[model samples]
Target chain A: MKRNSLHRLLSTCAAMLWASFATAEVTLNIGYLAVEQPRAAVLSNLDPIPDDDGLAGARTALQDNLVTGRFLGHGYEMTEAVVPEGDDPLATAKALLAATRFLVVDAPAEVLVQIADLPEAQGAMIFNTSSGDVALRDNACRANLFHTSPSDAMRTDALAQVLVQKRWTDLVMIAGTRPQDQAYASALRHSLTKFGLRLSAEKEWAFDADMRRSAAQEIPLFTQELGDYDALIVADELHDFGRYVLYNTWQARPVVGSEGLSAVGWSPVIEQWGAAQLQSRFEEMHGREMTSQDYAAWAALRTLGEAVTRTNASDPQTLRSYILSDEFELAGFKGRPLTFRDWNGQMRQPIAIAHPRALVAQAPLEGFLHQNNELDSLGLDRPESKCEAFE
Target chain B: MIRVATACLMFAQPVLADEIWVTNEKDNTVSVISTETLEVVQTYETGERPRGITFSRDFSRAYICASDSNAVQVMDPATGKILHDLPSGADPEQFVLHPDDRHLYIANEDDAITTVVDTETRKVVAQIDVGIEPEGMAVSPDGRIAITTSETTNMAHWIDTETQQLFANTLVDSRPRHAEFVKDGAELWVSSEIGGTITVFDTETQAEKAKFGFEVQGVHPDRVQPVGFEFAEGDTHAFVALGPSNHVAVVNADTYEVEDYILVGRRVWHMAFNRDRTQLFTTNGVSGDVTVIDVAARKAVKSIKVGRFPWGAAFRPTE
Candidate 1:
């Protein structure tokens, strides 16, 4: 081809591309509300928190959404509000609600409830992407709020199912001092009972021993009292001493719970079913591996993207109805299309069972079956849910 | 001219003395299942983490994508012995041999590049940078358009075979694990494992024609993870391996309607039809076996235990 003709072709194509970009009509704004959570006190020397954790996942989802959104003449915008410590979350949520109908919240259970109760957030749909509090799905369930974060109950059940499958029915639980740690312990106990597993003993770790300072003597004494159990389950939401309990256990047992071989929403180690792609993308964008909160935020925003694409509408009410309806299902890279449970408004997804290094397994493990959906076995099923108005 | 050539090749297809080759990912071996007996006649050790497998168009050599070894192993089909390794880049998970039988397009997952190799010379011809973790590779029937589905990018990138340039990037659902062109080459179907949807794209228009979602009673919609697909020639039905759901969705090609869900082994990955298209075999990853389906009955006829994790499969037709 001659240079003149080639230049003419390039100019024609560029003009057509520009014209196509000019015709986009729909714009969807997704708001992310999170607190700049302080780094948790860890027994290990490693830094536990990434400066931008959950927000990075949401940002990736926005880019992913825009990739498809462009073809449909839809554009996506993200609004982020990171609340500082002791600040009023209501103010941040209010500002976000005023800007967009869809909000992905990576806040605590109390903050989520507070935001959901705001009149400005009445008709808007908010996704709980961080809090794993069970009460949010129980008595505190709001009509407008949907949870992407797997509740404490879900996480415990996932671990329990894996234990039952592996025939590790005998458990020795180590509970932490924090309120959330106690709550997780309670949920684990309930999971054990439901799954027909016997809890050999429950030891209270007052968390007074900072393993970093006095681990050589204290860890040995702390884990000295133990019966013959197949697994040691630790509930340490504070990350106080869970990491230290793995190699220091008196009994030769596999440790599982918040540390060791634990159940997760997402882990960097997950490579099967095309999770490697997601991990690589997250790594390229954030310069680090994606955490559970990042995955939860991504899933929430991806759910919004799916609903909007399916319905071809940005209306919050339309999206809510579609998500609640049988037609609303979002594939969340958990080997299935995740859907919202009508009763609790909790998105049903397979929980990833992993240790710090590798994925141990996925739950709804081989034999534990449910009548409706296998994932239903992990959380509060329809018959047991106490939500006010279940569809 | 292509149609006439294809007709001649179809008529000249070899006899039914073929062997089924299953790539055992964990064991680093290939299980050769006899087509006549439906039994593993032999297992040959290959490179580490053998995944995708294919035969040259003329059936002279078998190429196996040894992902962990970061190379594609060429082996003698008759002897089941490794001959040489193709110059595959980092983590060559899946690949396809173009109809010309000359070029091999491999998805170097970790490198985020599709390495095109000249099979005859065993040389790297070209490497096109694609989306992150590019897994699935497919070449159109005409040998003109090549596609690589970038799993993380969630887009099926169409590359012009001649120019070696990506022309269109059609965004689909999440985590697209595999791509296949229909019989006529008018459409392309890309399976999104995480999204649980198989999006069909028009090859000419570069538009999404339709999307199919699988629903098996008692199986969560999210667990209906479509990974690999096999289209039965001359039939309207195509079989999709649903990961972890332990079922194969039989979808009607013309109408885009899923006709039936045939139960199979756990975590079914990829599949291949026999020379006669009478039997379809699926690699069940978790179960570590291959489920053979009788196409006429649309049922899983037998489960053959092969290896720790049987991933990809192909049939070697014997003359």
Candidate 2:
């Protein structure tokens, strides 16, 4: 009778042990915040933004992280808060920062600055997956902020290097009316100066897309102007009139910048360096091609997951120190081991120069030398940076 | 020079394998180079996009994955003639022969299935469903476990050979292209083409033990992609083919440290060692050549021009 009682006790202890192990799974909460900016309804709808925009990318990345994390006995959960138009994003961010240690933000520059100033955000790690402002990368950098999205300087530098390599030094620059377009135009001007390229002609894209139907006949007249340039560089960040300018150009030159042969953080056409696998996985989960925003968000989460796996720790403090250390390197299948810049929290990666069909090349081209890394040639280098956080 | 002396010593040793075969991926042909003469002995036409070629246990027949043809061609190793074709599922990229010399594990990339085929009967015994884009296949030295690296899934799946059931799937890195079991199934190594690292996992614990990265100055870090791995005797040393970096890294398998980087031709994909492990041959895709290396000396000895886009190489024993 005593032996029988002992067997029952042993079985109960085993069951309790299994239950304890099941509940030992660690869960990581990733917070995301983005502002809803409805694109202007234009007549020329070339590449329209999805309803889920940047959130879809984060979702895809969360799915990928979970796949890898499952083997490591880790579980990932993302809490996404999309602020409505004109709503206070900083307020929403504050509430999210209360719960999650890791956050991915797609807010504007001003709102990002506001969120970075919050005392509650001191311990949280924020990944800027949207903004391309060069100021955010330099003067306005935050100790907590990590830019996963390529800066404006990186994008324009990538295009400029490719153009210089192809001997397309003469550029016909066209600027749109949007503020973002003007910012991109300024970055391109700096890139042109850095690469020793000449701006052959400068034109303003005054043609509104809504006027396309009534002013359809005026399209050819607008493009027939004289410009002896090797390529047409268009800064149409609002998706205004770039795609329409492709076949309607006066000269038979290649179109570059935001549309044709453009530089991007991630392109769906990139199949090299095992990007096909990432593309297929995104397609399988979201049933859509991965956009640049999706790739940025995915990269941010992958950085976190890599740190956690390497350190074998889930604590935010431990992960942050490990990530900032020189020992931390995450391979995002970009053909190199991606590391975060110590001067600024920007993740150093190769900018893919691609078209709609295939990858043309990568930035920091051959002969573009840097004392430390070739990727630093794309954006604000150590000496040029004013980010006091790392200093 | 030290490299020249090692080359001379390698030549002085009697060559165990008389011929070496390279699969010309784009040209649909196999280039046979004689070890004694070190020259292309013959060329034979193959099916579309021939890749991942291997010989049978007795070296009588060569099994080549005619990927575009969606079949595995069984060819005469002596003459490089196609004797017959085995029923491999769609898009067979890589395959491995069982140590028992009967079953062949063929990775059907498009189908996401690892088809186990009986070589004698030429029939698929089992189709084990795995992750997407299954590219690499490796059977444990003990013949107990079969591993398939699914590229899109970035996982190395372990399937029990007896049960033919998947037991565990270990995520390595982005776009894992190859899986190799070293140290007699004690260590499992998977190469990530995009991640540019070789992740080693413990076979028993099924835990990632260590990762090795390569660095070649002047070569972009992304181009230092680890692909095929060849082990020397005693599993003490290993050579990893770094794709497009134009280099092969000699790694101390025991310490997991990269000892040396030997420069080779452009886009070196796969390699093969002679029977005595005295020499190594690497197929360079972009340069359209095969680089011969002295294994002991750890240097690229010679480069021989071959067909366009050579993919894989295998050593054939003497007749």
Candidate 3:
């Protein structure tokens, strides 16, 4: 009888060992690719940019995914690669892609396209977290590339909707000298035309003087020629002169577009629809306010995490297919389920129209109807994009 | 004498009918509706942005989740006066009373933690870390299991009440706003608001048993967001509040199929059943009204206007 008891104990030990193996944790490795660039000097020093703008959001999302992942016997590890200025970002992206097929990229449109075209990135899913260029979601779209950042068109459309709702039909445009500013200006022009708003006058900002010191004197005179308009649209994408243009405008009208009251992917001012919880969590982690880039990066990583949790697999191909499928819906704290546009791989979400202090409204605003999804009204709809990669 | 006669009439009927307490989120007040008269009898003040409201097992006290205030207020239901505050973690969005009658599981949305407060002692027994933006809270009938559904994490975390630790976590649809343990704790049903689906999990195995979505004939799919749900007396049917769709979906619990959709006011948030489960009162947030549903007829019989942004509803017995 003693020998029989010993055998039973040995069998129980074996069973326990097998059970542990059965429940062994599955670890997923995610890659974060950030391409450093020279940011434009801001006119105001009150709100300085953080060193870890997009990266902090990805880190927080990693922690969030682990909270849900731990209960499912899953673990996640993030690999980061910050490509310095003038360096070949494609090389870093290639290396990271070799290590992990899932990458949250904070890079420009050109670099994003380069990485997506790499042979090594065939099945890999690349999330663009920083680029807002409209062409990336239009003519230059890639099959594997998904954008969390709102396209320039989306932002402009959001602002246009607000203008239409407020009946601010006549607007003047001020285009900056920078390429990004000019791009935004063109997008603003397109949106103004689309929404039936008239551009009363348009002018390019020619002054190279320091806006911080001379904005009050230079802006009024610079904008004096534009004449009277309901609102002044400034396309200073780098925040260079937007702050100064807000109050110093020639006319006592609302200043919008890239400053004053602007359309954003996410903002700290947004507190409704359970966004306060997200903002608090982010502030607790990184002692600063969450910005638009941070929100984009967070959404990118969370998208992968959601797909992984649902599909029960970490393979890039499986996650990509699942993320693109009808089953995938990301609760982005925007009071709506953010879904990717099938034609362009752009995340369809409500853009918040706000100033620095308070949220004015969220677009796809009421009465801005669409034949399909209301969010589709803000960006490149299915019929607007030229890229056929998703097909 | 008129007051004396009314007092005598009240004394004649010692056991008054039930009262439906609805929390107005924007108004920061609780409107007490007389079930007998189907009207608001009294409105009591509450803390800022009260989202969740519940009563103790014996109906002696009520707990309100004052989300903006970040504290759970305990009130005397008899007098509608605040008695004390429970040490709820920051941003208590929703909470459930454990079957033991003394423990309250509060889902702190800001902290991503579940704060269990002992009502009698007014002390936090345990603060269990949960997923991000935890909003939904529910406890099993036997008090063995508790569920916290995190809105952002999109997962229903199953907690072991005895140890106060997460034993299992199951993935639900996007933005799970509410969870309920039904059929004597045999199954747990979670409603995903943004995903527009209800996921039911088998408690024994912690496996997803069934998942279903709602559809109204003319409503857009995006508007059909399932938020809060309540099961009928026998647990045979479920009434799910579909946010913004302005309809409540009646589902056959056993079959996991939507039997019908009863159109109500705009942005229906939550519902509470009157005594005997014959009538259900739903709080409509946008319309600032309550749609009363006759359970047997499966139709909305009345719409009573309430305060602005009515969010949560609870039935209080007057006897």
Candidate 4:
């Protein structure tokens, strides 16, 4: 449309190419923007009410991951810049990415997608550090973005596998009412069915005009302990009383619900294999524990770090190709080695079952070994996800 | 007379300190245990999964690693009401007090990141990516470097504490869980859960210096997970928490030998020593007890059942 002006401008730039666009540090500045501090009432807002303080829990997850990966060489360095508390994160992110071509965030999906389409986003890659929404992988999938957090489907599938292994085929579903929460509950229900489990009872928690009233009746109604059913499956993504539902059920059996025993990409107590060493260094850095986000982010970064290190270049396309190549070896967090799923860039890893005290167990438990390894059995299999990105 | 008594009562109340004085993770509350009282004093309610706990080096505040909430519930030690929440990586567990204590290092479990919070600002100034499943963290005695053990990868990473960039990631064995840089800063002893051994590494080269293991039965080969440990540099002796076995293996770091094994309780998680180093307190998670061990005798002096799943303990009594 503007070939005449483009020709003149291009000719001028071609003449001065060496003068203006000189080689540079090619620095990657990562900005993690959040309302308030990341740890405050952190999962608290998972619901209207905040869960217990997981400071110790999140400390081990400093890198946003504990996944094991090592760089072969060095070239790309990830630098981080934080926006002041109370500052508008989107604005801060836009400005930061304008200068730096790569970004990683701990914000929600709406904010993530918002920044993905920013004018400055033309030649950048964004890693979603939070927001496990599945839509990001499908309908909203963008070539320039990647997600380290597991999709809701991934988490649900993991939990379903744990249920299947335990043979806790009958699940009494106590679900919190939110669009996302409902979607999560429904997905788990579908997974339970898909994996050959059934929902014996289904209950919902409506948001109360008054928050206190809802908190009061939530856990008690969930009082059905272990024996009432094989297990209590609560899908209150919003912590609310999901964390409380651990042993607070009627039947008094082992609970695998929202807050307490949910499955995830990583766990802090997984000292098996070479994970402890990673945990140690992270603690030394942040002076605390690690979290789920820490594991995913670390894997994503390490994955990318290894790729860039191997390629020894800042070219994103080249680095991405190196990662997707079959020769990559990622052995950081989850002890056993792993690689990226071709369809979606999701790291194929194990789902750990954890409480605040210690990790209970990991999914695809010991004996349920599969052809490709039991750990990979937890999340979405290669056959299930429809994303053609990997294909 | 009644009005006078009420006024007196109000004035007699103690002033609360600014930090989260004490916490019990399994209990879902923190006991604002006064450092002044070498005893269980008071308790405060905190967010969910309050496991790893530590105070700012200055004692201005206390941080609890709430894994379930994916944040560190910061608290005023005085009132025990949460002061603010720091966005920590998820599943935060253990923490290391910076030698300066101005900064508190967080081991976030879920997110697998190490978050450094400036105690003065009480905000995360740096969030560095580390290995998968980061757990126990320790700062070098010289305060030059920070070390975290990512459990899943079974690796220990050394951070240039000043820059917070991961300078090196040293691979160890399966399930490398916890670490402690020896008091002298010469070497670091890292524990492995699934690997079931303690690896000693030269802090500089990150090379494996030595490894110590158990020589007895009942120690499930994989279950002989080495968790919490304490050692003196020149001193050849150290103590390691043997997971699920309910025992603390006393080892000689010089020769890489297991000198003795002292049984504690089921699923022993962590341990801390008294100022004099004469006594050791190890938390027995499954048995719900804290075993007090006499360092010299290498024997369990007492087993005190504190609460449901007691995880951490400390002695802040100044000499």
Candidate 5:
């Protein structure tokens, strides 16, 4: 009885120590605000992209992380509030703040600014999912929230880095008229100038879904000439009509922009490195493959999860400070480790360029250099952020 | 490798009194030897490079680990065709059937998952990921516990099958190779390849209980040593195959001591026991022979030259 009691005492202490070291369950909340403006709806649906299903790729990824969290002791729950196509986004956000602590808004940049100004949203984390306007990351930045998707300047720079490395010097530029669309057009020109690529010609076309019937203005300059430029760079952010610009370039050059050879956050054909398991797990959960937007959602939620894991606290103050500080480190299927850019909350990650089915190239493409990780080549860093948040 | 392998086949196939199925690599088949007649019975074809073999609890079904095929082939001891099986993921080197008989845990060498397959369903039910490149595994008598040796990580994962969680990752040798739990579920013994020592760990606390290492030169430091082992009941001893030592080391389970060494053929890889643990067999892959040892005397009674390179030795259940 004496020896048995001693053995029993030892076993109990060991079991309790093991249990305490492993049982921490973290639940991350992601709030989504949707829109249904006729013009925005037309632009989003015109490209044969399914509605209610457009964000399926990203939703699947979030769901996968949520499932992994359940068994692995980390949890994530995403709740949504829609700002129907024409409703006032400010009124919609004000009404939804009661239930949501974190917002993943898919709307225009101006509306995102309005959401940031609201007193109720001061302590909440807002993720700008839809807009790629460079202004949000620069002049109009917010201290409490973050951008999951790449900014317009970042996306254009990714392509520029690749075009410069490949020496595709001459390009035919196209444009769309949305407020952010105009920002992308200027960003593309900035890319050419920054990378020393010469622009052959610039053309403008009304944004339309039927690229084949309405792409006449884009076609004549691109398809008929077969002249000076090596590739066509189309900038149709609202409708992404650049896909039709390729093979239609009169000069017979490949196209790059919102279409062919486009650069973005994530793509389906990416299965190298340690990506296989992540890909397999996502497929197992969502019943389909992933898209670029899905990667942004994954990165956003993953960063928050990392912050919680590192700080070992769920308080908003601890998480916000970790993400804003220069001490953050995380690896989320980007082939390289990524960290927050300190000056801004934008996580520096790689940009994979591809068609719907094939990956044409990955940015930070060999020669593009950076003081830190080469992936910083795809986004704006401290020297260029112009983001005076901490300054 | 060719000539020595051919000579190994001379003593392989014939009707025998004692039934011991030996997986021969060169001949690409398993030779059946009858114990009473001390000769061959028949041969059964298995997957390429079949190395591990164990019977179901009832001793009616035999599961063979096909390292090259990356699967476990289950067959009726009387027949050779793959009647049923499940994916071993990749490069399954060895596996142990738990006492429950409901689950068969496999050690797929190239992967980190220790795949657990249900015998009745023949499907991979759960895969508990462990340290890199898990090679050998064993389950305790109660079926509530199991452990796998992770070669690259140089550790052993003590997992709770009921909870399906890796409860512990206990560090061991530079290349912790294989593990076998002693009866009563009180202790688990692990063999190290590089460290050339057997480390005994407490089952509950997983603390290093004791250690055993050989003393002779070249004998003491065996390269890629302690590949696999066989545990016997009456003697409560374990015969450890010392890979480069070309010998088998006898281990006293309770005291954690290497009591003696029995010299055998070159590159000994695995060991097995007879029905009552009175006889023993060691698969010498390089020498291409099976060394039959008399357990009581602790000596090689006879060394039978078997087909090209025998990989497995399994005994028939005593009726």
Candidate 6:
């Protein structure tokens, strides 16, 4: 009878030990905020915009983080806040910051800046996954704001590297009137000057007719005035007329930038360096191809997960310092470990030069050397950055 | 009459030298280097984008991971002909033959799973779900534990061989390219390519015991990526292949300190030791050549040109 009682006592002790172990597991909460914008009309119906663009990537990354966290007795949870079109995004951002200090934001540059300047968000770490404005990483940079998306300058620099390698130096550009299109055009001009390329001609698209029916008739005539060039550059960020420009140019030159062979942060054609598995996983989860915004948001949440895994802390201050440190390296499936630049808080990565079908090359190409990092050749280097927040 | 018979027997028994087989990724071919001649004897065609190669226990059959073809092809070594293909999941990058000499654990990069196929039965025994982008595979000496190191997930997943279930998972550095068990299965070592570090774990407790990084003078730290490593005959010393560093690191197994760096060809990926462990051959990817290293001298003796983008190497013995 005494032995039986001892067995029961030992079993009770074991159960309590298990309970204590379970209680020790850490739970981390992250926030995903996206300001919904109206979808732009596309000339081609083959490539439709996905409704769950940025959110799907965050969800997929949450699953990836949980897989690793489960092994370490940690739990990850994400709270999503999508402000509809014409809604007050600031109020939603303020409420999200109140709950979670870590946020992955898919919003415009202006909205992102406003969110970063919030008093409640001072101690928060905000990741910008959508905006590509260069000012976000330069003059208007915020200390807490981190950008995973490639800036306009970075994309144009990538294109310029390929052009220099292929000897397509002389080029002409056709730009739209959209603000993004103008920004990209200016960035392209800057990169061309930096890379010693010549802009033979430039034009602005002013046609309001439907491009689906009149692209072949109107585009060649519109491009005829520019004369012959090595290649044609288009700066239509909205995908409005870029699709119609390809194979419709007057000089029979290759169409690039925003259509045909364009520079991107991520593409479905990227299968090397273990990116195939990521693409397959995203496709299996969403039943569609992964986009650059999806990749940026995925990278943002993964950055937070990696920081949490290393430091075992949930506070934004600790994670922010750790993320910017030299020790942090995130495996971004780009054949390299992605690191954040201390000067601008932009993630350093290789830009994919690809079309819709296949990947042509990656930027920071051969012979383009840098004194510090080869990736610095693609974006605003430390000396060129104007923001003094990091200092 | 007896003297004539003895002479005929002696002529029949010709000495056969061992060979080193290397898979060329871009060329889609296998370059065979003879140990005696230390030169390329012959080259055999393989499936598209071959990366990993290994030999069966008896050394009569060879297996190649035809990555782009999505198949693990078996080859007859004596005739240099492909026999058949095993049912490997999509994009098999690396695989390891179990000590039992039947089960092959293949890391399917696209499917994120470790596929176990029984060579004798020509069937898949189990498909174990692992982390994302599984690139490295290793089996313990006793055939009880198998490890799959996922490059993107940065974790080494331990599988129980008997139950085909994951028993433990341990984190490693970023972009882990290879996993190895040493010290009589007491320690597990994983090399991270981009993180430029090798993490050692205790096999019993699944806890990280030691972590070490590599540095070669005049080579940037970012380029010092640890990929494949081979231990000396007694496991006292180890030679690690540093990818893109153009050098192989000699590490003290006990101290985990890099003792020396032997400059090889450009972009060294993997290495193989001779039957007697006297010579080492490194497959250089960019230079498309193999650097022969003298074991005791710790120097590169010669560079043997091979196919384009030589990736994996395996030693074959012939008695």
DockQ of each: 0.29, 0.28, 0.62, 0.09, 0.03, 0.49
- TM-scores for all candidates: the values are 0.80, 0.81, 0.89, 0.49, 0.58, 0.86
Cα lDDT tens digits, model 1, A154-202, are 9999999899889998788888888889999999988988999988788
Question: Candidate 2's C-alpha lDDT?
Answer: 0.82
At residue A326, what lDDT does model 5 achieve? 57
**In candidate 3, residue A27 scores what lDDT?**
65
Better of 2 and 5 by lDDT: 2
TM-score of chain A of 6: 0.92
Q: Clashes in candidate 6: how many?
A: 0
| C-alpha lDDT of candidate 3 relative to the true structure | 0.87
TM-score computed on alpha carbons, candidate 4: 0.49
Clashing pairs in 2: A57-A294, A335-B222, A336-B222
Q: What is the Å distance of residue A197 in model 1 from its true position?
A: 4.8
Q: Candidate 5, residues B1-319: lDDT per residue as tens digits?
A: 8745643553463222446778875575787765544455567888877777877777678788877677788878856666876677776766888888878888776556788888887788888877555766888878888898865445688889998788877766545667888767788888866556778888989899887776544432323367678787753888998866778888887776778888888777777787778888888887888788888898988777777777777887546
lDDT of 1 at B22: 98
lDDT score, candidate 4, position A210: 53
* Error at B53, model 2, angstroms: 3.8
Please estimate how well model 5 matches the true structure, expressed as its whole-model Cα lDDT: 0.68
lDDT measured at residue A279 in model 1 versus the true structure, 0 to 100: 83
lDDT of 3 at A39: 72
lDDT of 4 by residue, B204-293 (tens): 788888876675464324346677777633556888888776778888777788888998888787776665677777777778767778
Docking class of 3: medium
Off by over 4 Å in 6: A1-24, A210-213, B1-15, B24-31, B37-51, B66-75, B80-91, B110-112, B115-129, B142-145, B159-168, B202-209, B216-219, B259-266, B286-291, B294-310
The candidate maximizing DockQ is 3
- Please provide, for model 6 over B68-107, each residue's C-alpha lDDT reduced to its tens digit, 9 standing for 90 to 100: 8999999998778999999988899999999998899999
Candidate order by TM-score, decreasing, is 3, 6, 2, 1, 5, 4
What is the C-alpha lDDT profile of model 5 across A8-97, one tens digit per residue?
A: 111101112123234535556555566545655432344544353324544644544442233235555555555555456776676666
